[model samples]
Target: MPSIPLPGFQPPESIQEVFLNPGGFHFGTTDTRIVTLLGSCVSITLWHPRLRVGGMCHFMLPSRGVIPEGAGYDGRYGDEAMKLFLGHIMRIGAEPEAFQAKLFGGANMFADMAQRCEINVGERNIEMGLLQLERYGIPLVAKHLGGESHRKLMFDVWSGDVWLKSEQGRKPR
Candidate 1:
């Protein structure tokens, strides 16, 4: 067998796989990449233009206080995740005042769960994510949230492009 080289192709700088479990959050810098598989949880991406830095966090719960155990050491709740993500970007020389945001996930895949609460967990997650962005005064520029399907998101900090993959199709921003 002979090997053939593909044309017009370049390898990614680095690839880091991250699983945002039911309650998990993570932040990354321009040199680091972040990826997540989401269902009913919500993921928020915050980016700063001047510094070309960004971070993303996937949160299962809307508020940290809602969980009796507190967000623990992981800070998995949406509110805590937002704060941590913002802090991380700022630490990397990104200006908080110049940051923009984008939200994804928060799908109602488990419609059955909706009957248990006045508002669906997925909906609450989206609401809380937006609220957190607003509280931090970050402008939300884009979003691909809601519906009843799971999503896989890959974020490039340097380019500030978020790629979303779902059963239906792929959306790049």
Candidate 2:
């Protein structure tokens, strides 16, 4: 049998799809694409343009107090999530300065309640993300934060592109 090459026909790249949950994180090479839905939570994506490797974290709270002995790192808190990201980056022998960061989510799902509460979790989560990025000297190239709607976030490690679709006035089921 003779084979014919068709013009404009190309094989699709094999992508590693990951759906990140609240208090979870994932990091991998160019083949990885991470997706997550956020409401009153924050997600930070770090991508190394040169190495084509990075990760993302979904954190619900700003920080947590004293940790009990033998307690492992929990991504639920923004502080702990940042620590997890740092640990992975360090293990891979990469410096924070080499990566570009993106911030998303931190929506005030309960608008009326937020005004009465002493601490707004959504705002605090955004603050924590900004502070940690500053502390580590990671440049925040893009951000979509502090809204009143939920967001569906998708991050591509290969292209370092982030796609955000806001579910305005509707809560995720």
Candidate 3:
């Protein structure tokens, strides 16, 4: 899909680019684009329309369950990733509500395993993202969640545009 450009915004001469790996997160200002590949993992993108600043996180799991204080934050976990995003928002003197969020990924790559397990990781990851967004009062403006194929996603922080392309023909049996 074509990206909808933000009004009154001019493209920067050079835009910073970031490719996030599983368990990774990135936050930056207007001239940034973050990309990631996903299967069962989930990614949350947050953008502030006014400031043209935001971040994205690729998390593999729902939670690590009450990490001990002083332990560093791990972007691998959904909860921790949200906290990481929050810390950055605060550091930039922005409120969580000022941001618009988008969610992607959380595909069921192992159908049989997911059915056999009590809780599916992909589903849990997606749920964790939704819960965290609500808990922080950040509005989730868009999402493409839960499927059988992998996905490649790109988020443009400058325009709050997210482009998602589903990788077809690889559904789990």
State the local distance difference test value for candidate 3: 0.89
Per-residue alpha-carbon lDDT of model 3 for 88-138, expressed as tens digits?
Answer: 999999999999999998888888887888667888899999999999999
* lDDT (C-alpha) at residue 76 in model 3: 99
Per-residue lDDT tens digits for candidate 1, residues 1-173, read 11132332222467554555556666655555678889878888887766666778888888757545543434568887877876686677665668889899888877776877556788888999989888878899899888888888877766677777786632322
1-173: candidate 2 lDDT, tens digit per residue: 11132343221279788999999899988778899999899999999987888999999998887766999889999888989999989999999999999999888888888888766788889999999999999999999888788898888787777888896663422
- Residue-pair clashes per candidate: 0, 0, 0
lDDT for model 1, please.
0.73
Q: Which one wins by lDDT: 2 or 3? A: 3
Q: Ten residues in a row with the worst lDDT in model 3?
A: 164-173
RMSD in order of candidates: 5.6, 6.4, 2.6
Top lDDT prediction, candidate number: 3
Whole-model lDDT values for every prediction: 0.73, 0.86, 0.89
lDDT of 2 at 94: 94
What's the C-alpha lDDT at position 117 in model 3? Answer: 81
Error of 3 at 20 (Å): 0.2
Best-to-worst order by lDDT is 3, 2, 1
Query: What would the TM-score be for candidate 1 when compared with the true structure?
Result: 0.78
